[model samples]
Target: MASDVHRRIFDVVARIPAGRVATYGQVARLAGLGGQARLVGYALHMADRPLPWHRVINARGEISSRGDSFSETLQYRLLAAEGLVFDEQGRIPLDRFRWDGEEAPAGPAGEGS
Candidate 1:
């Protein structure tokens, strides 16, 4: 029973492609929750589906550390598996990998076809 707000946020997150990423603020704005970036994070934390949560990062082009080293490491590995390379300071170059949110899939993979 995901709330409407969380579902909206998840929809925007699912649109982020495999190799591109979006910031929390960016996803929030796109989900029509502008200026509530933290809401995006909270929704994702409660997400149960296989949304591409790893594709969302902080506005500073780095993963938002949740103080859970395991999840943080898993996020880094997931992004790397999608061919994202981090700089020496462990930040992805947003200019090179940020999604423009123009090419959303019709629905989850294998749906709406």
Candidate 2:
């Protein structure tokens, strides 16, 4: 059986979509995990297998705080390639680009939704 923390992390990751982003706190809330945003981060940190770790960011749309300098730079490059526009300050404009997590129901025509 999956541990509660692992399940919670997976639940949060599953909700993040391509071209969108979510903060650790937002994912925790959506997973009904209360104020355990740090727990979410910890769980992710312990994960060994590959997952969409890049789709998540801070509430301010910045990368997670646990990587080397090169990793941080790579995060920015990958996000930029995904069409995520950033401001002059190198910060993603959360107000304009925040992922609202309101994807349309999956269907033939809503594959990207």
Candidate 3:
């Protein structure tokens, strides 16, 4: 079974809307796991659920490259499908897509209800 911290991270990740993204630090704070950004990354790495792992980036507004270009490319594609646009330098514009900690609407569409 997953620990409470892992569960909390998953919960926070699940709340991130499709078209929006949150940094690992942002997710840690929202999960009440403050300052545990790396922990959040570890949890998502092991999570078997459909959590929006692609929606969680690093504080630099860029995907944390796992030394694998394929996964990096996949993340970019997933976010692009959600309407997120990254800069030519592979940096996402956090100002445009960052989640504001507002509650995600209770639906599959990810719109505020």
Q: Model 1 reaches what TM-score against the true structure?
A: 0.90
Residue pairs in collision within model 2: none
Error (Å) of candidate 1 at residue 7 is 0.8
Model 1, residue 51: distance off in Å is 0.8
Error of 3 at 20 (Å): 0.3
Q: For model 3, what is the C-alpha lDDT against the true structure? A: 0.89
- Cα TM-score per model: 0.90, 0.79, 0.90
In model 1, the number of clashes is 0
Superposed Cα deviation of residue 57, candidate 2 (Å): 1.1
For residues 12-71, write the lDDT of model 3, one tens digit per residue.
888887899999999999999889999988999899787889999999899998999999
Predicted candidate 1 versus true structure: per-residue lDDT over 54-95, tens digit per residue: 999998889988999999999999999989999999999999
C-alpha RMSD for every candidate: 3.3, 2.5, 2.2
Q: Which residue window of length 10 is worst by lDDT in model 2?
A: 104-113
